[model samples]
Target: MTVPQSELQQIVSALQKSGLTVESVEDGALIQHGESRVALFAEADHQGGVIVRLHLDLDLYVEEDSLPDILMGMNLLNQGLDYGTLNLDPVDTDEEGEDSGVAFAVLGRSVLWLPDLGVAELDRLREHLRRFEAEVTDAMERTLHGSKGLSA
Candidate 1:
């Protein structure tokens, strides 16, 4: 079962309000805020449960950037993604590609996934995404301000 257009709109609006630049795609939506980019897809399972997948796309401006940072962030994103699933349990998760699933696609950027999440899970995911956006924004502000002071 496909998700209602209204619900999808709510999800998009929630992400946008969280400071992410959102774009609608044929199958789902894309969110980009700060150094992070994410693609989200919503579908229904055989049992009439909704499934949501979040794919993170990380931006690495410098070639010498630490891979560990990227990996760590991805792991955190995955954890956050799973939070959505666990909160909305009683649904089955599609784990065919556990380690390397289409949940995330990194074509020069990092990506992560959150699968088999229902409406409630999506709501929670929206809240979590908003918090993540705020933290990231705050950190960037501090970093920039600190760098300016040091260069002065």
Candidate 2:
């Protein structure tokens, strides 16, 4: 069951509203977001499962003063819907044969697993994702606003 463009747009909008910018690829069927300059691809398979790919730039790294960079990466994977299990692939080269630095970090950076979640679980997952997004957005806002005070 392929995901509808409208639904994808809604999901992307919801993500963007939470402060993360979203970019669409593959005719708006896939979405990429986050501060690491990574693009995550999501597509529904014929068997009704969603395939998610994390494309990372080799040079991306988190600053020491920022929130635990490892946790931030995990949060991105944990943001997936719980209706079905998510399968992740390790860092690999794209079709053009360019290195993507996409490696499986389990709870750290990359992920590949099956959730076997039901409708209720899916709802719960969606809520969790939204809440996480809100928290991140709030923290970012606070940091930005607080920085103004430092300059003053």
Candidate 3:
């Protein structure tokens, strides 16, 4: 939306009405779906549209030594996905000041104006979030079993 603030409220309302529990954050909303969570932030684009960033966090975790394989699997999985891009996201650290496990995420962004924000668009966004969670779950399971991500 042109006015980022007002449009953000509309987006949050739509999300809540669609059955997702959205909590207002400083800049946007936070949504939790099962074991996965998504943080959506709204910002004004240069063209007067609003850019909504959907950072979907998966429940997948990988140890330090498994980083390489996990990354490869993530890439392979991304190649087969129709939306979002997988990436390594940092997690909490250990007690000895050593880095702990890592989490994978699918980052998706939508740019739309006030006129384009509607039920159909909200549904599309929700669907994409579901897809991302599924892909991450699959990739992690396959990686842990010593597979090279999802087969194309």
Q: TM-score of each candidate?
A: 0.40, 0.33, 0.65
Query: Which window of ten consecutive residues has the lowest lDDT sum in model 3?
Result: 106-115
Report how far residue 32 has shifted in candidate 1, in Å.
Answer: 2.3
**Tens digits of per-residue lDDT for model 2 on 34-138?**
343444444454566444434333232332233344445334434653322222334343545444333432211222221423455345434544444344334
Candidate 3, 1-152: lDDT as tens digits: 56553767887888888888889999778888776677787766677656677666554555566777666666676677565666666565555544544443333333333335667777766786677656655555665566434321
lDDT of each: 0.48, 0.40, 0.63
Query: How big is the positional error of residue 42 in model 3, measured in Å on the Cα after superposition?
Result: 2.1
Best by TM-score: 3
- Give the least accurate 10-residue stretch of model 1, judged by summed lDDT: 82-91
As a TM-score, model 2 comes out at 0.33
Against the true structure, candidate 2 has what lDDT? Answer: 0.40
C-alpha displacement of 58 in model 3, angstroms?
2.8
Clashing pairs in 2: 85-115, 91-102, 91-103, 105-110
Question: Model 1: how far is 48 from its true place, Å?
Answer: 2.3
**Model 3 / residue 134 / CA error / Å:** 2.9
- Candidate 3 differs from the real structure by a C-alpha RMSD in angstroms, to one decimal, of 5.1
